[model samples]
Target chain A: MASSIHDLARHLNISIGTVSRALNGRADVNADTRQRVLEAARTLNYSPNQSGRSLRQGATHSIAFMLQPHPGDQQYGEPFFIPFLIGLQAKLAESGLDLIVVMGAPGDYQQERLRRVVETRRADAVVLAWTRREDERIDYLTQAGFPFATLGRSRSGAKSYPSLDLDFEKAGADAVDRLVARGHRRIAAIRPSLNLNFAYLFLDGYRKALRRHGIEVDPELIASGFINEAGGYEVTPHVMRSKDPPTAIIFNNDAMALGGCKALAEMGIRPGHDMAVTVIVDTPLCRYFSPALTAFRPALEPMGQRLAEMLLASIPAFAGPQGPRIMREVWPLELVARDSD
Target chain B: MASSIHDLARHLNISIGTVSRALNGRADVNADTRQRVLEAARTLNYSPNQSGRSLRQGATHSIAFMLQPHPGDQQYGEPFFIPFLIGLQAKLAESGLDLIVVMGAPGDYQQERLRRVVETRRADAVVLAWTRREDERIDYLTQAGFPFATLGRSRSGAKSYPSLDLDFEKAGADAVDRLVARGHRRIAAIRPSLNLNFAYLFLDGYRKALRRHGIEVDPELIASGFINEAGGYEVTPHVMRSKDPPTAIIFNNDAMALGGCKALAEMGIRPGHDMAVTVIVDTPLCRYFSPALTAFRPALEPMGQRLAEMLLASIPAFAGPQGPRIMREVWPLELVARDSD
Candidate 1:
């Protein structure tokens, strides 16, 4: 059961080539040499299966995409996934390479699952999406000798990993700049949770933009939570109730910005007139909203395409670099000013 | 290259087994028979080395999950996909089967991809999501003799495939029941586009529930579009603007329900106070929405587990039963009477 080629070669005391020829049924080997190797193999009960040998050689023409559960199940109810997947598939389709989307459970061992994908010859590479600060998936994929690329950069040690990201900082700063240009000084910002890397980048942009405009960043003007519409709706009343409430508000994402508009409308305040709001992710649907939203347009299609290419080029044992390679490209967010601001 | 064992046997006019034993290196065959088979093979230039033929005799032990891109780009910001995947992974984990999630772009040849998955022996079985009316995928998989289970039922001509589905009609009717039980009439229902089978089931449920209460189903009460938050938000005003506006409204899904709640609030109408609302799926985050929300609790986890079992049980030779083996499970709607009741 544990027989090795070397052991069989030693038992026959002949060249391993004769043993290989007999197993592979090569006609070049002499009859006597082939017979001798076959008899020895029969005596040892040896079986030279190709799959086991292929596993040892270590290259599977497949890649895995690790998907995190939508923060609260709202992610699937929106339309953002279609374009992102189309962009990713466009690149992978060119090489005829396969993509495996792996969804990790809350308490499931993501690292172990990733390890199995690589070790079992299931996939030669991986692509990590919705990355968080100090993501365990990145650490494990990096350590497991698998080539991987992330959709977004990690907070602490993502430099070693190849990632494609949007400049959230610039997007955020630009959101503020557009709002300020509209003669709104007391501006409020609805940000994503502080724990996320993008959230912090957005905050930095907001602060920088405010400073450049000679306005101080006030803690009272900042509201934070999940970057969803419900989060925007829930936080709007609190911001409006504040004693010197802002004339303009910036939301972390487009969905939340729509929620903010609804909240203002609920308060009998017209979004574009009495109050102004800006959002990130300038999606096509934004134009359809009652008061079309003014938001930042991140090049999500190119971002997904580049990430797929990087993962495809980084297949196992292909050569130049080992571990995750870090590549950054920022597509400037265009400010789509609509009725909202 | 096209020589078979029978071709060699016919030439010699000897037993096929004698020829097989000769080529297969079996010692039971006479040396003369072995020589004849080899000479015939050489003459014909036969090469029995194709990967597909060998794979047929060996098991790959991997499953392919061909995923449809979420309806559009806005869905990424929603939460439906993450949990469905988590549920799927949990079921696959018990059997130690690896799930290879593949995304085929719209207008791409999905059937060809499925054929390749089988031809290349990359996966032993396939699971197709987003099964549409008159689905070409189901037909292709069936004709190719591949094992597959669909996430949803199709309204196509044949229902010969194995599928795990929820009784969506009952779920829809139950929403109306809950709303009516609370003494509300003139109910409006928002549904997904009729192109999908689930949408029709939901509409049927809505009508049945109305009929049960001795009310006529009004065409004006139904709205159709993409099943997303914005869809709910945008359609609500139209419903409310009706000359005889509905006192209660039912949403196809939770995300839309949340959006409907926001829309009502914007119209200076608190959900529970101004009008009643009910949703389909009871996503985990529904409990955290400002108004909490009243929704039907579809058995997503169990549905996933059952689907996995169906796919695993299917054999390569399975032509499916004479009639569709449709496993329908109806989970009652857990009516949580909150502020939005």
Candidate 2:
């Protein structure tokens, strides 16, 4: 059996606390004592109980991230997750908080999982990436009185939770405006699932842009699909086969844009030549594509950092607000015109 | 301030233990009493210190996952992560262990993070993915006496660790055999970093297969790149433009295969017709590609399940060798013939 802290304490004829401090690399432990304990532990192959120590320390210094279930096998092409993680990690690095990612089923009672994290003290706080309408996870966290911040907002109201999200509607509108400015009258919008609040918001922005341009919104030009490459690829054939196909297609995300590019290639249609494609979420891969993809920049790193800060602050009691605090920050989507658009 | 367990105890006129039991849904507490305690806690918006409870229980019922850093943007088009995650989650669901994933930069001492989890009691055991040659993480875990199982084997051997891994060499050799059987002598192998143990093994398999078929191993045909889609795409133009490009190209992974497919499409060289492409790790998206991808099955789900079970068993004292206990299981990589090859 591996030696425990108690066994080490006995072997060294020292208190368990002193041995623990040495093992934990605590500053209080004398160098000689620390070395002794370390040497002994090295020989005995001792593994201490970390959870117990964290409880005594009053902080786990860890953040929990729960992933929403991906419905299909389609890989989401966007590198949004990496930037978001980088941003979160950048901030957490300062405070010595490590990110602990968790993948949960879509229909799974995520609230229970969140509660468990808090109940077990596995994390000091949680950062929720995917937000849904009437999010029970948010509500349960709120009701259970745990601190958390979401990447997206709930449709019900901003008063209910703290979230950091791009003005998706504005982003969608910007895409349409960019297409219209390029002298493309008939533009199609590929939106994400309607289940998400941002999906509806983006659609509204598209409609608003069309109305401002005095161009009637064509329902046939709008299609909803998963925010992935395949989603974009699958819908391309449908749009191109249409009798009055739009000259420009705006995608909800970059993954779909990749698919859209592939579809155009298949149909012997050059995206920037025969048809224009603008994708939201400017990722590094966009620049590497054959023609280089045109996309909107959300600056995900900053967004992730802001969200982490908001969640950290929201954990303590707020003196000003009775309802849940709402902090809204809208980043301008810079249209990086590449060959595809 | 949010109500605490003590506050709930005061409000319900019950002991802290009773309140805790009720909150934890322990069967020992009377259902009626549990309901009343729960109701009072809910009304007060009580949230107990989860860390403290976890320490007391001596189990966090969570699993820790650690990944080694890769060169370039960590979020490159690597389809392996998502599927591996899905498989891990599927096993976790059955075992009721919440997964806590941590990504660390290469050469970073992850032992501190592992210690923190154990000391804080945030997790019962750890599942280490993507093991490398001479992995310090494995040594640290073994010396520290923490329970952990690896996704891939370490150079030291499996006697010190339990691992679920593919017969990378066999997979590589089989690809060559298949291509050779199809009357192809000139072949190119797109390899990942040769520094990696698995990559070297795969190259060895490739060499062995070529030798059996009396074909000399051409160093010029072996292009080393990152195992990602963009890497595949980036290499395509160069490979296609080469004066003596092979008729068949075998990718290290599926993401790269897709990139190769896209590149072939761009060059007006139809995959499966003009150039054969084969990738490792089969998934549903392979079938949807323009020329559906021919690939190897990694059996990720079963591997995850087995790893979880092994880790769980190792948590307690096991009478065995003191050095690394290595266990390697090779799942057959069934070839799925598709349009791509």
- Models 1 onward score TM values of 0.69, 0.82
Instruction: Say which candidate scores most in DockQ.
Output: 2
Per-residue CA lDDT of model 1 for B1-341, tens digit only, reads 23566777788899877877788799998888788789988897554422222244565555677765435323434345454556666777777566666776654537666655665556667877666667787887777666677877786535555676666788888878877888878999987677567777788888988998998887777786566667777787878888888998888876666566667867877766778777776764454454556776665666667777666655543224543343433344455555567
lDDT of 2 by residue, B1-341 (tens): 54578888888898989998888788899999999998998788676665565566666667778644466545552345665666676677676667777755333546665666554445667887666667777787777566778877677533666777778889989999999999888788876676566777778888899999999887778877766667777776666665677899888766666666667767878778988888766764465455567888777666666766565555553323453344567666778888777
What DockQ, on C-alphas, does every prediction get? 0.16, 0.31
Question: Candidate 1: TM of chain A?
Answer: 0.76
TM-score of 2: 0.82
- Which CAPRI quality tier does the interface of model 1 achieve? incorrect
Q: State how far residue A85 of model 2 sits from its true place (Å).
A: 1.0
The fnat of each candidate, in order, is 0.34, 0.31
